[model samples]
Target chain A: MNGPSIQKPEIEFTDNIRDRNRYGRLWVYIFRFSTIIGIIALATLLFNIINQSSGYVVYEAKGDPAALTLDGVPIEEQTKDQLMRVLSSHLSKGAYSKLDRTKPFAERSRNDVYDLVVERIVKYEVVDSWLLWDSLTRKDEITAAVEEEYPEALLRFDVWINSDFLRRPQSSNPVIAGVRTAVLGSLWTIGITILFAFPLGVMAAIYLTEYAGDSWANRIIQTNINNLAGVPSIIYGILGLAIFVRALEPLTSGTLFGVTDPTSANGRTILSAGLTLGLLVLPLIIINAQEAIRAVPNSLRHAGYGLGATKWQTVWSHVLPNAIPGILTGTILAISRAIGETAPLVVIGASTVIYFDPEGPFSKFTTLPIQIYQWTSRPQDEFRFLAAAAILVLLALLLTLNAVAVLLRNRYSRRY
Target chain B: MEQIALGYPKSRNGLKRRFRVGENAILALLFISGVFSIFTTIGIVYELGKEALLFFRTPNVDLWSFLSGTQWQPHIDKFGILPLFTSTLITSLFAMLIAAPLGMGAAIYLSEYASEKVRGFLKPILEILAGIPTIVYGYFALTFMTPLLRTIFGRDVVEIYNTASAGLVMGILILPMIASMAEDALSAVPNALREAAYGLGGTKLEVALKVVVPAAISGIAAAFIVGISRAIGETMIVAVAAGAGPNFTFNPFKGAETMTGHIVRISGGDLSYDSIDYNSIFAIGLMLFFVTLTLNLISQQVVRRFREVYE
Candidate 1:
């Protein structure tokens, strides 16, 4: 096979090997660095949110608190009766009546009245705010800047994610704004979404795995599901708008059921958002459930048949039980995605500012992500801080859901 | 025979009929559920097509002009889609620029170099990155990435709502997706090829790059296409950070509205049902749907071909 044997360049070969090894090690570092970049991005995102959630705020009241004193008694020390008198005198008749109608002053506690006085009468306006990092690192600069800019303003380090932030409803004032309504809306929407999507998805998966033969209809259905999974989420919003919001308004707005709310007389209700999200996640759930069902051993089915169990009985008793954990894991992940979705809800007209909590599927709604988007869009820095705080809550909820899903998959998943 | 022996023939016949009915009913229900997914696709096409047809039928919205014109001021009766299309292209391409190399590198590391324990730890981290909400990524784009860019390139050079920040953050948002998909593809490449490369004195990097990666090129390409499709369809980040109004520009430093961003902006406002603005969003949405659907189908086809090659 060899016409001539050439002398081997041993030294050159050794040199080439050294160079290649050096380049190889360098590439390994580069690849590792590439992997670390994602971690860094995640860390930075969390850090940014945390940095903004707690911050130093410089604020001033339009009306002096000292002016509300009766016989040298401070507003905080004053009785509820005194606070009510101060509020009535300062606020217009219409405003005071509206406040009274909302929650009668008679039912209000002393502290509540005091808070109202401070909130409504004093009208604390945020002049400036600095993130946690700046407040901690550049404290003297911020102090000097605030002192020079706003002499009468009070400075305080405020933690924006307190219990009050979770309990209170939305407010135009960033200091008092909370995610109570948004959280409730999100809960109601997600609950309905799961109710609609879970059974339908599992059933579809069962039919595909257990019943469907190799027919053109089944193939098209399978392909359609895959394509639907990749469709832009906003397109689903369009479908929701045209179908659920308009075509099925009688149902989505609960008009057919005779449970219509004048505020949400139209179909931009939690039910519509929920149904849209259910559709959005349907393919995901189906695909996952199919995989889970396929993982069930064929022997199990044969064994069930040997015991004279019907096909339906075999699927319901044996296949479903074993596939439950995998199905649950997939559903949880899908639901988490639905939870974070904002565009579809926005397209379906999720109210940017709604103070009342959503009571049912027919109620007008806002979600935590929607709140964050709305708040972040505001020109005010304080709203940005509020948005950051809300992001913390959203992240916490998602992380917990993911952790549960992971645990379920790791703990219960069978190799088979 | 057994029923007749037990003297319950009529009852046994009735029970069998009921069981048969129940089984048929269950099958019908399951079949309907399976068919429901098809209805979703039909609904999307019907709704999008119906509204988009009306959008095109409007006297001012010439289909040719809408497809060709550069200006996109809907308020001024301008219905040009080029501005939005170009912006989408610019941002998507920029995202791929950052995502492709980094994602491929990460995929290689995970598939070829990392130990089992390392993979176990890294994979979940990547999943976490993938699972983080796009809205959160949008927030990071607006608050962090924009500021970082401003500091690096000067405030005057980098607009607050430029595509650069949005695109960069979008790259981060999709990196995990590309990485995971590409890793799956790379891992699918048989190890015999790797050993054969090593027998010829191939280094780990050479084997991974020259041998394994080439073998899995189709799968990796499919992953890239999917990543690009995802970038194009992504809404929240662009809506939040990629400017409000559409501008026909290729400059990443200057803010421009994407198709998804335009839809979000217009729909977020209160518009009458029959208004042009309301219908225009659907038109944009239809285009987005078709584009993403085509890309996804292509990627799926590529994946199928790759599977045939190995399996």
Candidate 2:
């Protein structure tokens, strides 16, 4: 190592250097802290959601479910037919007839009938709930509290996100509530969204990147897409309501196709919501697909042209195969977004309390986010737990979809 | 043999003519697909503008009073835009307060300090944060942040459904947007400037802050602007956590309605078509569209400016 130089700079070099070192070190910490805050925020979100989703609760049944059992079998162990019979036997004749009229008892799932029985006839009500930590740390206090406050209530440790929660339909009574209808609706909406957006988006991307010259029309199209991507989703809802719902009511309601239900002729159907969401995600898919298309090397195109192939032939054969995985990745991401979207759907008039599964595009629907929003808005504490559970389901679905897209993208990336 | 060669040329010419026709048709179809975005924009403007004009022309709307007034009680028929605008502003400002520093700091860390491996790993995690739906963020704000804030500031001081809770969650929601965009801007700066700073015996932090950040200021500004636009447009979180009623007070502790929240509230409720209350939502939506659209356009311009300078 060389010795220190005898000639020093005129400025206070050592002091300035020390000061700079301190400032730099402080800034490093600051930046690190900033990134850590993001990580912490994510952790907190997951933790908070999980924390709300499970706990111990003291529940009181409105009536004894055992009273409906004819064979002295436990209510939980009853067969599906037995459960249906038990459900009808316990309800008042008027109530039973009304329920039958809503949907034929035979047509509904065994699980659905059972949940209805539990909700309407048996009436499982959460008298009180304790957080997981409180239930664990202060068991005696909770026990005493339940004993004193609700002498007839049974206390049980409940996992809010159980399979039953997935199987049953939404209820005013949170104990028997599930996300079955919402899940089906979300799937239907996203199905239609992909159907409408994917092909159009890909075509737009291909035209913009491959076919179009540097013309004013192409530039305007690009500008419109960029601006559309930033438009608030609620605006799309207004468009859907005006154009799809009101202007094209016959088409959206399936009336033009002669599948008319008089009650649903108003055009507030899954079709409208799906189209609105399709518009919401269209810009995103186009942008991503363009990127994917642009990433295909010019050499591949040159080679195709050198073989005397037509432009369309080159694009169809050489360009598309390479870009398919990327395009799919973008489409999947857009689907994830469409599934989670609430604002545009809400604006398009998605039902907040639809009990039946959406049978077709013309059927009224409610998505998971809408369900969660509705549940959270309710004053009941049990519904809050149910909302938390629904949130978990939504997150899981989103993450899984995202993971699949990422995996496919990585697989394709390795080949290139 | 000459007749055979002439036949071949004739067939080839016919095939070429057919191909040209088919190709032009296909290009037209693709061009139509590209033009859909312009159609969407026109549709949005027409739909919003048509309803908004009707709302203004409705009896007793008094456009002047509606613009300048402070109270917003639609049920009682006092339709002031100020309360909604103010709440939107307050929440977005507070969100910016949280997002600006943290997002910038995270950007600096990812671009200047973290190794390539770390950045690759962390970047997706940040994207996960961005991917979490605003509705989930709403749930988080309502169930978690409000209670936490209550404990810190005391129960009476912070309402259960207040702007602070929604604002904070909204900040967290937009944090990734800011950080990712800022990082893109920072990394886009040429390495030569950074290398020159290091050669002058500058520390890593100094080189980043003094050299890189300034070089990327336009981009960082764009990121912040976009973040603000997102905050202003965000609906679910504010709708769920922010108070249902429109309060005229400036206190973030008290619940007030934002423009998006107002739109959602009206839409969720069973309001009749063409009712004053219903039309008012359209008007509020028009204002929201204006604000976000302007901010977005400005951000785009700023980013374009940066691209010209750096790229």
Candidate 3:
């Protein structure tokens, strides 16, 4: 019927091409600007952290180092015996014996003795500190302020993230405090988290992708996993507090194994923290593993089946090996999330001031994020600098993990 | 074949029988693993519910009062949750005000306008933004954003620990989340729709804004909802930047504690077990869990509806 209306209507084009193009260009710029905003935010965050991590500090020593010099030798050039003698004479009798009791001077290295002399006798206390930006641009102002405010204090530019900071454990005094214990705790917690979450996540993914077959139960399981992935991480901490820390205290505290330390008999151990993190990351791992498994072409499975293979055999021999790299990439990314996660760990009661390193799964622990959180909360400005330094360490760790994941995904991802 | 195949077939059948048992066993193991996620959900509900029940049962705390109360001082036994709830709402809304438009714009650009090279370069940057820890974001809020806010708005107008800084930094934290999700949704819109619009002589902006965006609206809505839920549930940022006490104030510059912030602050302290302080955090956690869960379910429903339209 429409064939009868063959005549074309008068072609009229709207004369707003210029306006449309202008708006289009403006919109594109807006979109581009949004992305630039994110980059700017990231750069500012990094810049801020780096700015705080190294700065000039005005420190006052409790006693003059020149007073302890032996036969006109400066404290720095003194021999190990001389340093020990200086420490012994300057330190109280109780303090001297306690230091020797903890670790005998004979067993201690010469540098260790010298450090003790400096820490105990010299006792450098930071009177004031300036951030890198101010330390650079307002150098004269800071110098003048420090001289007027702290006449006897020494002014020096200190990099907060030094080897000594990394080597020492946490202390109440910000001058000597370090993230050594927190770093060890993070490693231990993450090690246990991987051990707990990886295999279970992969197997669940295999089941959902292969064997579940769209059953109602499987659908519920799938939905549950998605919902769990969205659950606030702190809720997992509550669960850990209830389940791992309280209800299963015997297991988490190593009481059941008869290896409990009286001081650490509570369930706030690395094991509980790790398990909590594992649960928190489980949904992430499963979702990612499922994606990896689904990416394995169906042809691989069919080929295995054509060769008279069982379902598990096909999945194990063909699907898993093909999906391994993708799975690992996803898992590593999830693990990095766990590594940075502080909420649940805080809820699960990560120790904020633990000085000793985590000895095992049963030991009380504090993670790097916890250290950063605690340090940032302190009213003192120096603690903020310490937190920034810890943040840099954490960022370096997470970036390394992300880089490895990206490399693995790029290197081994199969085209099919 | 006629002479020796008899013994081979018998052994093969026996081996198959044994393999069947192993297969069933492995399947059972995998099934349990899949069920573990369900158990986790149950565990969360059970733990939160159990403690929350105890909290409600306390003579000092009634459900009605807890829901309607304004002050949340646990030491004085004031357990009203409105202060924390409103603070959370205010921060989340503030964050969404920033994240929603920016995220949608980035998504539209990446999906509709960006060249492949641009998308590739921009995507990793967003990923890095997402990968940065929230604690770092919290630090940024406290150290950089707060001071900047004070400078712009004036120190007298802005508290040192205020919701404005927390919400602003939180927007940055969740921007990548919304952008990537919305980008996926926009990218998923059948190209035929864009072509149809273009054939009708729609400009690039018109095609994106009127045709593609409306088509992907549900997915974008879901992304927005998820972003809000993330902002609500974000603990470290609010805890570190938001004030310690619960204050029912609508002003973004005023100090107030979110539910999450309260939980973190109280629980971070050395609370004895079975104390009202300890139990109250769980109650707050329970409320947080449900709010986030409801938001998540709604987003899932929206996403599912969107998937149905396309698939």
Question: If you assessed candidate 2 against the hidden native complex, which CAPRI class would it receive?
Answer: acceptable
Instruction: Tally clashing residue pairs in candidate 1.
Output: 0
Q: What is the per-residue lDDT of model 1 for residues A1-416, given as tens digits with 9 covering 90 to 100? A: 67788888777634488889999999999999999998898899999999999989998999998899986898878888888999999999999999988778888778667768878989899988999999999999998998999999999999999998998788888877899998999999999999999999999999888888777888999999989999888888888988998899999999999895968549889999999999999999999999999999999988887887877898999999999999999999999999999989889888898977788889988999999999989878899999999999999999999899989999999875
Over the stretch A121-180, how does candidate 3's per-residue lDDT look in tens digits? 888888888899999999999989888888888999999999988988898878888899
Q: B1-311 in candidate 1: lDDT tens per residue? A: 12111211245535652346666688889989999999999889988999999999998897899889899987789999999999899889879988999999999999999999999999988998899888998999999999999999998999999998999999998899999999998998988899999999899999999999999888899999999999999999999999988998888989999999988888887657979998888888988998999999999988887663644
Candidate 2 — which residues are off by over 4 angstroms?
A1-14, A80-85, A262-265, A414-416, B1-19, B306-311
DockQ of candidate 2 compared with the true complex: 0.47
> Which candidate would rank higher by lDDT, 1 or 2?
1
TM-scores for every predicted model: 0.94, 0.94, 0.94
Model 3: which residue pairs collide? none
* Clash list (residue pairs), candidate 1: none
Kindly report which residue stretches of model 3 are placed more than 4 angstroms away from their true locations once superposed.
A1-14, A100-111, A144-151, B1-19, B306-308
lDDT of 3 by residue, B244-280 (tens): 9999899999999999998888888766788898889
DockQ of 1: 0.50
- Cα displacement (angstroms), candidate 1, residue B117, comes to 2.0
